[model samples]
Target: MQIKADSVEEYLANVPEERKEAFAKLRKTIVENLPSGFQECLSYGMVGYVIPKSIYPDGYHCDPSLPLPFMSIASQKNFVALYHSGIYADPDLLKWWQQEYPKHVKTKLDMGKSCVRFKNVKHIPYELIAELCEKMTPEDFINIYETNLQKK
Candidate 1:
């Protein structure tokens, strides 16, 4: 569920009161763990961590006008979502998460290739999310994105 917001602050303000705390904590964790050179902004109606055009002139392959997305967080109608592009691009990361998340989260792990959905705030694995954020620096993500693009 994307909420139209001009900035990260605006995005947070727009989030429902019920989800505020969780979102704030998750946002904090992401910001703290994010590698240098990644900027936080509103992208696709969510809080997005991106590689700015100043560092990666190519921007996103799908949309040159937009910065290259590293990760994103959003409060959905039913759950809060964490999207990590690095985990989606790397099979090893995905596999590791699949194996490790269950040990940490009491609830069933509801996840896709990159998006981890949490129906309850308590179910969110903050440490794992931080690890994912730390694992991919802007330069690494850009290189991976380019390498994948070439294969297509």
Candidate 2:
């Protein structure tokens, strides 16, 4: 099989027209909100935002290759996925998020780990996604992820 594109624009170009509008909005939202050190690229056929190894030379664990990514958004067979890194690292926020976020939320979405899934673009909560990004920072995320890794 062919490898997925590297840029989000290229990834969008490969998707069907019917799915474009929703993904367009989500992509715009993510681009507008992504922090410094984080960038948009396709990973495993999905749009992923992470600290490139060039920037985080030590990685999250001070290792050369380990990553402490912020979030990843993907359009799956049945749903649009929002993969939040803080879901595991920030328990307090996740507890509130689990309760306060809109109902009909889908969890346990595995794309190597967990993701929140939605069937339609409208179902994806742009605000909450924004909050998650704003709340989780690359530096703090690295520390938290490394701590968890040590725990395990």
Candidate 3:
């Protein structure tokens, strides 16, 4: 699942051929919905969308050297995982997702605070996922991150 690759392309190349198309489609949706100023790259052995250092000089609070992570997509052993930091930090967003996701997809919503696990590609709700991705701009995420850090 967590294939250690140097780049996004390499990560994708290593994914099983049967899973590649689904990953590509999900990646495309993520890219299309991502707000400007976020960079796509490999991070934590997954394809990560991040707020580049230029925008947030401090980078990720957990690791200042790394870019601020906004979202990520990775292939797991049994499921594909989609991570959205906004949903994890924003109660309203999480509530909205919990209420709305099941309406769009018949399957059970396999999700954690930040990660959504998809067992089948067809069961993924791209529209909902895109909507969630578009909920926060890089600036907005930085604001939230900083605020949360201050609280800690």
Q: Is candidate 1 or candidate 3 better by lDDT?
A: 3
Off by over 4 Å in 3: none
Best by TM-score: 3
List the pairs of residues colliding in candidate 1: none
Each candidate: what lDDT?
Answer: 0.88, 0.68, 0.90
lDDT of 3 by residue, 1-152 (tens): 57879999999998877789999999999999988999999989999999999988988877899999989999989888999999988788889999999899999989988999998988888898889888899988888888888899
- Model 3, residue 144: displacement in angstroms? 1.0
* Predictions: Cα RMSD each: 1.1, 3.7, 0.9
Scanning candidate 1 in windows of ten residues, the lowest lDDT window is: 1-10
Kindly indicate the candidate among 1 and 2 with the higher lDDT.
1
Per-residue error at 79 for model 2, in Å? 1.0
For candidate 2, list the clashing residue pairs, or say none. Answer: none
Measured by lDDT, the strongest candidate is 3
Q: Taking the tens digit of each residue's C-alpha lDDT, what string does model 2 give over 57-124?
A: 76655444655466777767776777877776778768767775744345432333357766656666
lDDT of 3 at 98: 97
